[model samples]
Target: MIFIDYLENVELISCGFDHNFSITNKGEIYSWGLNSCGQLGLGDERNRNTPCLVSFPNDDLIDIRIKDIVAGNYHSIFLFENGQLWGFGSNRDGELGLGDKNNRSNLTKIPIENVQKIACSKFHLFSLAHDGSSYYAWGSTKYGNWLSSRKLDGQPASFSAASAMILESPITFGLTSKIKVFQFQEPISTKSIIRLFNNPDNYDVKFVIGDRRILACKCYLKSVSDYYCLMFSGAWKEKVEVEIRDYSYETYYAYLRMLHYGCIGINQNRITQLIDLATCYIDKRLMKHCKTFIRDDLDEQTMPTYLPLVIKYEIKELYDKLSHITIEQVLPKVTDSILQNNENSIEFLDWFYNQRRPFIPK
Candidate 1:
């Protein structure tokens, strides 16, 4: 049953049997229900029917703030915004990273640091660290393998932070109760937004693009773009007619679509356009997503196309990442023609060679 007094400012929620855990907008934690094994972090195994604030001792005096929460069969762990891990629960199989099977009723700080994300099961724990360059696991060793000592591969995409909430209307008594809904959104090429555009009651403004006019909501535009926020926040003229002449119609539209939704269709044909547009808008998040796309799609044939954009944007992080993938995958096939045709790749090669790191022969 959903509680009538639902939590406010909650960013993420995790649940265990007879209990619930949540991280709030201020990076504070709240837990409700069973505390049989001290999972509630209330300093005792007392059950709380209503949500109770859970906090570390002197939390305000410390630099750590909780950002994520996960739960096991009877245990719970919290991940801090600064990449620290702490836990309080039954540790029958060392699931708490405490290196022992000891039960703790209070939040105990773990030694692990630089942890970006954490996950746990009934008898195991998994942590993604260094933004996913490294992974660490601990807990019940089973299936005849020491999974705890093994390293997992792949880097995680840039972290985007946002707060979301679910709103519920008052409960009605009858099955034939009214269910009226109201939502206003913008028009875009994406199929999801296309249908919303067709609804005459949706848009609040229109953005004229080339030969076509795209309808949009002023609130949405302001939410995603500082430039648009300034323009629509009573700082500029209140005229309904407005024309954007900076970026091309296609790129700007795609950018807007990305802002409305969380994704965009990207390929070799339009990757550069998106990145350039993101750069112009100073949208580091969008730019990071585009770079991650280019990183994953990097190949010997595609490196030429990607390298120039890396250089144009001065993306040193991506430049080094591309160099690492290239050297690790296609070093033996490197040819003089490949180097001659791509100057940016040549620059990467020079940087790689100067690193003085040992490279094993293929």
Candidate 2:
């Protein structure tokens, strides 16, 4: 029998069936067990009975810091602090999200970022973004569609054709699906990158926004967005230069930061502007953040300003939160004339009565 006596002074962070993974205090990943599909990341598909050090590729090996490990039946996923995701092992069903069904024997970095958690079940993989607003998956078609249905909670969602499917739902009420488009960012030093924006060392695309420029890798865009994927991946494509006119530099940069950092800081001052941009870009996470900020910061004085926004955006959670506060704090102080004059106030009153009125006693 093989013994893993060398695993001393190390903490077992997580484990999976027929495989074991651990992280040292210094944040190094070690794997053991089934390697039929190179799930051990050992550069080969041979199973090992003892723990072995999983090697990462040298080209992208700079500042290699792993934050989490997720293992499926015959595959493994690694998440890095710099919003990078690496996968190894079976891709028979495209569980690695590599846009194909080719099994990887070596550590292959996939084009995705800001992934908070990756749930690997029997044959399904689900990824949740750090912003708590988006979920992604690429696995069995049945599983992906099944989870999408669960996310919709009986609501309908539109299906689109992409390596990884994104189920678009209605954009109103609490039923709106919160989703995001992720991108890739390397941890390489600035000196290594050829340009700040235009065709940066390894980047494939550039977007010009007035005086400012944003550099990006096209892999994720092709997998996530329908427009760009169709444009660049076409057989007739020759050049790639995109002019972004829908969003200002500040808003555009903010969205980029969300892709790189997993979360972006936003203040109440820029909430409305960011919300508009998020809506235009179909960035539901940022939209949700804006609504959450407006809802959490609401009070008696700011009620008029934010309530209309809540109603307009159909943010049922925030609407209910503000409604509860209004019932307890604002309603008693309101005069009959104000309710009679304001349409929103009247609607609120009607809903409030319906909620507060008790049914027949049992």
Candidate 3:
């Protein structure tokens, strides 16, 4: 039963690539297997033939109503009810960030409070707290830099032998005074973000710093509907005029909810009709996420396989990041010997460099 659970209360189960698993119910975290580098918090360097309890200090006062669990390449993390975090199994590279390289013999308490989410990486962890702040990287290289730069912690990301580029965390421009929060997931349009500051549609767009008291009612909506409500998002010093028809409202609401939750509650038969009717405006972030989900999750044979074609149809904010460069970098290194008096060969590099600057007319 080395890989099988013998624990009676093991109500849920999940296993990962390295044959590691985190099993729990209330708030308790348990694991077994491949303790070679101490990925299992079972103390000794021996592998357990069955699951064992990975205890927490607060276990005495709580039933371990753990909110969530995730596994990485050689590590694991779980969220708790008290907003605290707990992790064990693999402390190498300080991914466990207890400020030590020693294996955490059992479930060790990570004093990160008010955590709303625990994002586990191959050897590191990411914790997003309730106050809209984030914490991460008690493990691994790439995840650490990504997490550090996420909080605007100032260390520029470094290129490593592992050769992966971590994306920057979303940046928030500090507000001078009280104002509304405008948030959007990835599929959102560049147009919407700009609309918050100034509407290009030729209308006078403005916000007022009223009462000097910030109204911190933050709402980050997923679908197009919440953005729809943004028509009333401005600070009003006078009466406002807005018009939204019934069909538009229902369609936006349904599309918005679907994009947010990965589920739509609208009538199944009318979904096609809704998609067809709601063509005028769409949240760009929603459209992108849908395309990504389709590409990654769907098989390659899927006709509308947006995932496989994502890189092809991708729009890069910085064109250099459009794709990994092989020939572009290598071509510069190629000597004139390879170009030996061939006029056609000389023209090739000129055309290639010009191609790299994507702004010009193709």
Candidate 4:
């Protein structure tokens, strides 16, 4: 993922997934083992064995060739060609300028003016420009200070471009004549997070439920909504077809109204059509709720309500399994009360509790 350009003039002298090392076209060097304190000047703390190349192009902020890299606990800095300054990787204390003590993994060009030099300490940095101006600084540390131009004595370490000299990493421009360490870093979000267990698909699987006999028959129910308005009632029992006198329209609008507004308005004779649609899914959740509604009132006219329609359609194994539990539990005090007893209910509950779990065992 780390791509290098004009690298033909480069060589892979070293690597430090957690360290540093660098080499040049002529096999020059710029390195130390893991720079836990940016002491290696590789712009970051990390150790490396073999040497690595650290040169970047001179014009681009990033592609500029690097003289060396260094790391501080919370900052890193880079020295560039033409006396140009660039830094980042960490600036929790203004180790980098353009004024905020912000850390940047990517190389950032510092906005300090003139021919220059910079240096870094554990959490402080110093810079010196062509004018020989100096700066003092702190924070992301808790200390707050500044440099020359006494009139600007109490400015934000990065407030004035002229008074900004702090860098996260200390860049040795050419020895003792280095910049002062007053630059501080800006804030960044490093919130701790538990990134795992964020997705359900990572554990998606099937789940099964309920009696099989009635459930199986429920699947065979044909939806009248599937019918068209041909108005020819053919003998479904045989292969005979019937013709119509006039093209009659099926009141499909009733079905549409039911779909769009959740209101089933089909007339009495047409009730079956919409009822089939409403209960077509044969959902266990729906059936669970239906248990109460089925016991509300008993009237022969409410055939669609109290009929054993679904029960008769259930799977034999599940029906038989459920049947073992008498009517006292399935429908105590109701028409099927005598069919299931309380003891059977207790046994069924026990069986349910003993079934294998449907989810991955936690």
Candidate 5:
């Protein structure tokens, strides 16, 4: 296999009809293969079997760091770190977005800014603004130059339009102002929500665990657990401080962190305690997350330890999965004494051996 070892740490690659382009982590652009229409952006219409460095036209090459590269049938587009776009190669249908039907042998900056993303077809190009709400389309209208806008809920609206002629420049298209546009509040991510955990800034509730106290948000806790929802809404609506007696500070802290950060902050050693806390609060989502971790950690070595816990919690899925473990897998590592000490393990062995006794000779 041909290895291009010189192009180390390549961050992105794009391929055209016959040409290819690559961008390195150091913001360097390289191109090779067919350059019949100057798609290689090498300042000349010469094909290159080996990769060559792509240079900008102006003397400010040092500041022209490329963020992304995309290639069409015979054209190429480059997005810069400053959110500006540049293009080269075939422009028969203005696919280069250069505002003219002329092929460019070198990189030429297009009249667009704050472009977060760029995509192209054989004869059309599309760009998304950094705002993430605005979209633009340009190039051959015969190949359908149009943009369809969806509602904030991701449902398609009954609004779509197509241009009749070639688009020499990028044009903004979406639902007209007359149409109702749903303006939904930006959803908070778990990563962002987790930042508020144990933060005293905007806490509406406090949990006193022995000598320690933890600040928390009522709205967040209410959303995750039915027990918290009822407790906070019914009797403790105005209560700012509540005492936790059943669980240790570590377990309760981990439980709150799990509510905010999912299972990412869960400690493997404290999973059993977390499961108990989840069960006490009747938090099925948290229980499911704990079960998933247990299932993924279940194997020959862990089977003996986790089997009883699985049965205690009535985790039928895990119990059924453990029932399928081969004797070969257990006998090699697990000893008879280890299996005999736990009644659950002994019972599992009895069931397993009885099921396969017909196949075993006397």
Candidate 6:
């Protein structure tokens, strides 16, 4: 194992496939390892076995305090505390966000400002705006084409058909509305509460899903959900084992986990089912979480699939928000064959067409 003894008070470190970079608490950046692509940002293509300080151009007036750093396969991006962004290294794919496909050995300032955070892959870069809503992306257009589907400044996003050309500069996308940040209430003690979840030792009830049986606590379940409170109080109080139907084991377990641990492990695949369960149980917290995911992360590709759910579940907030989407904007992303295969997608298309019919000219 290599030990970096010379550096002190290291605040952050990011590594690429062959190179690495570290930032000190005093805002000093040190880099080492491979330099074949100048990812070291040391102003030369020389590999370093020891850490070397990365310097900025003398003309820069802002202080060089880095808030975050990310190293791509052949590039490095730095986000400054004052919201300025800088990058270096390979530009063959335009990952540097410099508006040109020229490699830079030294740090170069990116044109866009008010950057709060940055993330990168092998040949692309993504930056989050200071407002925590809009996202800016650059680098390979192969992946960046997703941005073309979104409406920018109330206008449909347009892009060239040429896939060979890279997105040399950052382009903004995602929801225009300010993102709603949800703060989950901290549990009294996470470890102990989490231990009680699915633990057979002191479980008073067992919910059977298919052939599998899941252990749970009655008192804790009752405390978190009114459905559990009502079920455990009346004629069903003596029930020790209950058979669950309709929902899968994973979805049910995630629901129980939320009630016990105050959070759920959710993804796109399971979000729809979880939302249905939340709606059936009248769980406002889970409903809000589901709505937030749809509202903030909704894109043209997913709008077709999710629009039906938004309407079916009566998610007024998202329904109203998605009403702005035009049929022309989403129809191109989905073909008639794909739509015919899905009844929900067909339903959404019909509903969306009628909603926009008044605006379309005869």
Alpha-carbon lDDT, every model: 0.59, 0.58, 0.41, 0.35, 0.63, 0.66
lDDT per residue (tens digit) for residues 268-322 in model 5: 4556776788788887766776787677556554566577778888888786668
TM-score of 4: 0.28
Q: What lDDT would candidate 4 get against the real structure?
A: 0.35
Model 6 over residues 266-341: C-alpha lDDT tens digits?
5556778888998888898888878877775565536776888888987788765565554454444455646567
Q: Of the pair 2 and 5, which is ahead by lDDT?
A: 5
Best by lDDT: 6
**Model 4 C-alpha lDDT per residue in residues 254-312, reported as the tens digit of each score:** 33322222222222234333334345534333233233223322222233433554454
Question: Which whole-number lDDT from 0 to 100 does residue 339 have in model 3?
Answer: 63
lDDT of 2 by residue, 1-362 (tens): 02323553243344555776766545566788888888788888888877787776777556767755777668778877666788888777676777777888888987666654445543333322231223455655533422221231222121112212432432221111112222123322232222332345666666779977787766655554454477677841555556788777776776664554344445444566677777665766667667766754565545676777777767777767777777866666565546567886777789889999989898
Which predicted model would earn the best TM-score? Answer: 6
Could you give candidate 3's per-residue lDDT for residues 109-142 as a string of tens digits? 6655676544444422322222123333334443
Better of 2 and 4 by TM-score: 2
Report lDDT (Cα) of residue 348, candidate 3. Answer: 76
Better of 2 and 4 by lDDT: 2
Clash number for model 4? Answer: 69
Flag regions of model 3 displaced more than 4 Å.
Answer: 1-11, 22-29, 58-61, 123-135, 142-362
Off by over 4 Å in 1: 59-63, 122-131, 143-362
Write out the backbone clash pairs for model 2.
none
TM-score (C-alpha, index-matched) for candidate 2 = 0.40
- Listed in order, each prediction's TM-score against the native is 0.42, 0.40, 0.37, 0.28, 0.40, 0.48
Give the better candidate number (1 or 5) by TM-score: 1
